[model samples]
Target: MDTVTHALIGLVLYKSIQTENLSRESKRALLFTAVAGSEIPDIDVVSQLWDRGGEYLMWHRGITHSVFLVPLWALLLAALSWLFWRIFDKRIFWLGMLAVFVHITADIFNPWGTGYWEPFSEMRVAIGTVPIIDLVVWALILAGFLLARFGKKPAHLVFRAVACLIVLQFASQTVQGLAIKESAMSRYDQVVLAADFQPGTYKVIGKKGGQVDIVRTSLWAEPVLLHQLTSAEEADLQPLFEQNPEARTLAKWAPMVVVEDTPQRLAIYDPRFFDRGGSFLFESMEK
Candidate 1:
C-alpha cells in the first residue's frame, strides 16, 4: 500500500488504542507500539534500496512485506522491547500484539500485496481490494483525525467505527477479489492470479492463442483489467514440445504476452502493469 495510507492507518490505530477501553498508559504504549510495528515492515525497503537501489522496491516489497515475515519480525521486536522496557513488559506484549496486528492488517489491504506464504512460495497474496491510498479511505482518516483532534469525551465511537469500516472494506475486497479471480479463471482454461483490496488489485495470467494474457484491474481508481497476448512468432509449440518439456509449458503461453523477449515473458498480472512511472492507458470499459 501507499505511504499515505500507512500513516493514516497509524493515526486511526493510535486513536483507537488511546480509547477509554484501554488504560491511559496502555493507550500510549499502543500508539507507539503500533507505529513501531507498522513502520517496521517497511524497514526492509531502506535496506533494499541501499542494497539494490530504488530499483529493488518492487521485489523488495515482497520480502519484508510478507505476512510470514511480519509476525516473526514483530515478535522479535516485541521480545526486544520487552527486554529493554522491562517495566512495561506486560503492556508491551498486549499493545505490541495489537500494534503488530494493525501493521499487518494495514499491509493486507495494500495493493502491493505480500508473500503471505513466503519461504514456501513467492506469490504475492492480496487481501483483495482498494488502492493503498484510496481517497475514500483517506476520508476515513480525516474523520478519525477530526474526532481525535477536537471531539470532547468518548471519541472512541468515531475511532472504533472508522477502524471497523476500514477492516470491513478490506474484508469486502477480499471477497470481491476472489470473485474477480474466479471470473478470470472462467474466462480461460487456466488462470494464475492475485488480488489486493487495500490498493484494490486484481491480476490474472491466463492463456490466449496459446500465449499468456495478463490482465489486472485497479479497484480503487479504475474498474477493469485489460490484456493482450503476443508470442510464438515463428515456432509451433506442439512440434517443439518433446525436445523441451519446459518449452511445452511456456509454449502454452506463446500467443498471450505483454512482451516476448528471450528467456523472459511479461505476464502482467497487476494494474501496476500499465503504470511505468507515467500516465497509462485506461480501458475503462472494453470490448
Candidate 2:
C-alpha cells in the first residue's frame, strides 16, 4: 500500500478508539502512538542511503516490517509516548500494536509485497490481490471521514464500518485472483496475478517452459493476451550478477522473473510489471 493509505489507516485506527473519557494529554499520546507505529516500518527506506551492494532491496520492508517486531515497535512507541507526554497507559501500547500490525498486514495484499517473516525468512509474501494504491480503499476511508464530520452516528462506529468494508474488499479481490490463477493453471506451469488500477481487473502472468504470457483479465470478461515474452533459458547470469548485484537481488525479490540475455545485454524482470517497452522492476547490465 502507499504511504498515504498507511497514514490514513493509522488515523482511522485512532478514531476507532473510544476516547470520550480520556484526558487531553493521553489523547495526544495515543494519536502519536498510532501514527508513529504505522509509519515506523517504512523507516527501512533509509537503508538505501548506506547500502552499496544492492542490499537495500533485501533490507527494505525486511526486519522492520516483520511480525515478530510488531510488539517491540509498540513497546518502543509506548515508552516514547510516556517520556514525551508523561501519559502512561496500557491502552497506548495496544493501540500502537494494532497500528503496526495493520501496516504490515496491509502490505501483504499489494503486489510489491513485504517481508513479513523477515530474518526468519527472506521470502516476499505478496498476495497481489490489491493494487498498491487502491482507490476503493481511498473512497471508503474518505466516506468514513465525511460521516465522522457530518453524520448523526458516532465517529468510532463510522470508522469501524469502513474497516469492515475494507476487509470485505480484500476478501473479494483475493478470491477473484485465486480464481484467475486456477484457470491459468490449466495451461501454464506457473501463474501470477497482479491487480490493476481498475477495480476487478488484473494482469495475469502465466509461464510454461521459456514462454510467458501476459493477459489482462476481469471477472466479467475472458482473459485477453496483452504480450508474449520469451525467457533466455541459456542466459548465464553470473556475469550480470557480478557486474550488477541488483540483478541478483531482483531475482530473489520477485516471485518469478523472465531473464533476457542477448549479445549486448543481460537482464531479468518481473513480467507482471512489464509495461510499454520495459518494466519498472527490471535490473540490467551491458554485456
Candidate 3:
C-alpha cells in the first residue's frame, strides 16, 4: 500500500480503539503508536540515499518489513510512548503490534511485496491481489469515517465493519486472481498476476520461453490481450550484470524479466511495470 493509505489505516486503527476512559495524554500516546508503527517499516526508503551498489530495489521493503522485526518495532514504539506520556499500559505495545503487523500483511497482497520472512527466507511474497493505491479501500475507510461522524452507530463498531469489508474485498480479489493465474498455467511456463485498480480486473502476465504476454482479465469477461514482449533468450547477460550493478539487482528482485537485446543495448526489465512502450524498472547496458 502507498504511504497515504497506510496512514489512513493507522488512523482507522486508532479510531477503532475504545478510548473514552483513557486520559488525554494516553490517547496521544496511542495515536502515535498506531500511526508510527504503521509507517516504521517504510523507513527502509532511506537506504536509497546510501545505496551506491544499486541494491535499493532489494533493500526497500526488505528486512525491516519482516515478520521477525514486528515485535521489536512494537517494543520500540511502546517504550517511546512510555517516555513521551509516562504511561506504561500494555495496550500501547499491543496496538503497536497490530498496526505494524497490518502494515506488513497488507503489503503482501500487492505486486511490490515485502520480505516477510527476511533472514529466514528472501522470497518476496507478492500476491498482487490489490493495487498499490486502491480506491475501494479508500472508499471503505471514508465510509467508516462518515458513519462514525454522522451515523447513530458507535465509531469503533463502524470502523471494525470497514476493516472486515476490506478483508473481504482482498479475499475476493485474490481468489479471482489465483483462478486466472491457474488457468494460464497451460499456456505459459511462468505466470504472475497484478490486480487492476478497478476491482475484479487483473493483468495476467505469462512467460513461455522467450515470449511474454500481458493479458487483461476479469471473472465475467474473456481475457483481452494487452501487450506482447519478447526476451532475448540467447543473449549473454553476464556482461550486462558485470558492468551494471542495477541489472544484477533487477534480475534478483524481479520475479521474472523480459530481456531486450539489440545492436545498441542489451536490457532487462520487469514486465509487470510495462506501460506506454517502456518500464520504470528497466536496466540496460550499452553495447
TM-score of 3: 0.99
lDDT of 1 by residue, 131-200 (tens): 5556667777787778767987456667778989877776766677766667676677656544533345
- Model 2, 14-48: lDDT tens digits are 88988899899999999999888889999999998
lDDT value, residue 70 of candidate 3 = 91
Clashing pairs in 2: none
TM-scores for every predicted model: 0.64, 0.98, 0.99
Number of the candidate with higher lDDT, 1 or 2: 2
The per-model lDDT (C-alpha) reads 0.54, 0.90, 0.93
Sorting all predicted structures by lDDT, with the top scorer first, yields 3, 2, 1
Model 2 residue-pair collision total = 0
Model 2 alpha-carbon drift over 4 Å, by segment: none
Q: Each prediction's Cα RMSD?
A: 8.1, 1.0, 0.7
lDDT of 1 at 174: 68
- Model 1 lDDT vs. the true structure? 0.54
Pairs of colliding residues, candidate 3? none
